[model samples]
Target: MRRITLWLMSTVAAVVLLFSYRTSTMGATAPDTPGVVGAAPGVVPGGPAPGPSAGSSAPPGSTVVNGTVSQTRWGPVQVRVTISGGRITDVVALQVPSGNRRDREINSNAVPALRDAVLRAQSADFDSVSGATVTSDGYRRSLQAALDAAHFGS
Candidate 1:
């Protein structure tokens, strides 16, 4: 009887510890920040990059965009979004850190809203993602940065 009781208790303890560790790790979020651009860092703290040349082949209204989306706990997430003639041409998730489950969850939750925002975007103004506000905001900022780059040829 005594041996059985000890074994049960040990099992319970192990299960609790495992559960705690998993949850704790899963709860962490990534950071939000600007990233490198065209062989140069994209998110320079001071300001944006220089515009494209006048003779460049890119269409007059077409834009090429690139930036990063990061969560608070983890590293940054690099993203690229292109807009042309006031419409979203592409949305890309570039670089996301590994091991942070929350970041993935946040991304999953925000994807729909992000898509809507891109589709409905007018002058880079759009709503935030529902469940993952921070992640959504980060993504939005990055998208906006990319849009700016595309429009202004930065």
Candidate 2:
């Protein structure tokens, strides 16, 4: 009886502590990236902004396609691909989570690696960056969409 009562009390206390815990991001507002304006469709308000206008010139024999915006837990992620000679020549991340210092720091390291991986693989089948799984997943989703739209690697 004593052991059971103690266990029950500990469980109740654990539940209370768990419910009372608060995360730093619980009520935080994610800041937008500079020079980014107008949220894409289905993107969270104040989230990823549009990239260069459609009228922007592309290199000869190269087509630029913007992938569908992917909403991540932290913010939105979007990729733009420049395809030429039936291959992805350039991969640009138009949007990434810049909501906080941590997000910026993480992406600063993760995005470049992610871009390089896609260029080498010629697809979005690369592994996710450690400690930035959410952003990596979002990046892959957007990149795949862009590749599909461009009919790249088909």
Candidate 3:
């Protein structure tokens, strides 16, 4: 019985040590190079790329949109907005860890206000969502981020 228990313990210890070493090694290596294992056959890594024409009209449409919103104890609120062609096409709740309770309220009250605001202002400076101040602020910030990216590249 003693011999069996000792053998089992030794095996478990060895396995744990091996797993730890493997995990450490895994963290040490760099991730796969950009154009190596799964890269396209002909494309070379770090190759020079073509430049856009000076006359290009801002790609003619929306290319991509992303946003992040953080939640607070006051409410589950965050904002993400997507725009194309100098217009807001979509708005998302980026950081609302909480359910849509307050979010819904904000959306209901703030969306129309926001749409009006967007239409009126040169940029995405919408009013806060009614009853959901934090969410409203987050949404506005997100919209601003998207609009800023659209207008200024930064």
Number of the top-ranking candidate, with lDDT as the measure = 2
Worst 10-residue lDDT window, candidate 3: 36-45
Candidate 2 TM-score over all chains jointly: 0.71
Ranking by lDDT: 2, 1, 3
Per-residue alpha-carbon lDDT of candidate 1 for residues 8-121, written as tens digits (9 for 90 to 100)? 999999998987675544543433323332322242222222222213333445555556444444445556555566667556555443346666666765675676676666
Worst 10 residues of 2 by lDDT: 41-50
Single out the weakest 10-residue window by summed lDDT for candidate 1. Answer: 45-54
Model 2: per-residue lDDT, tens digit, 49-125? 24554345566767777788788888888887777777778787878887677888999999999999998998999
- Sorted on TM-score, best first, the list reads 2, 1, 3
Candidate 3: residue 67 lDDT (0-100): 38
Better of 1 and 3 by TM-score: 1
- Residue 52 lDDT, candidate 3, scale 0-100: 18
How close is each model in CA RMSD to the real structure? Answer: 8.8, 7.6, 13.3
Q: Which stretches of candidate 3 lie over 4 Å from their true place?
A: 1-60, 75-80, 94-97, 100-116, 119-122, 152-154
* lDDT digits (tens) for residues 14-122 of candidate 3: 9989876642212212212232222111211122211211132223344333333323533333333445565554444333323334444445666566556655664
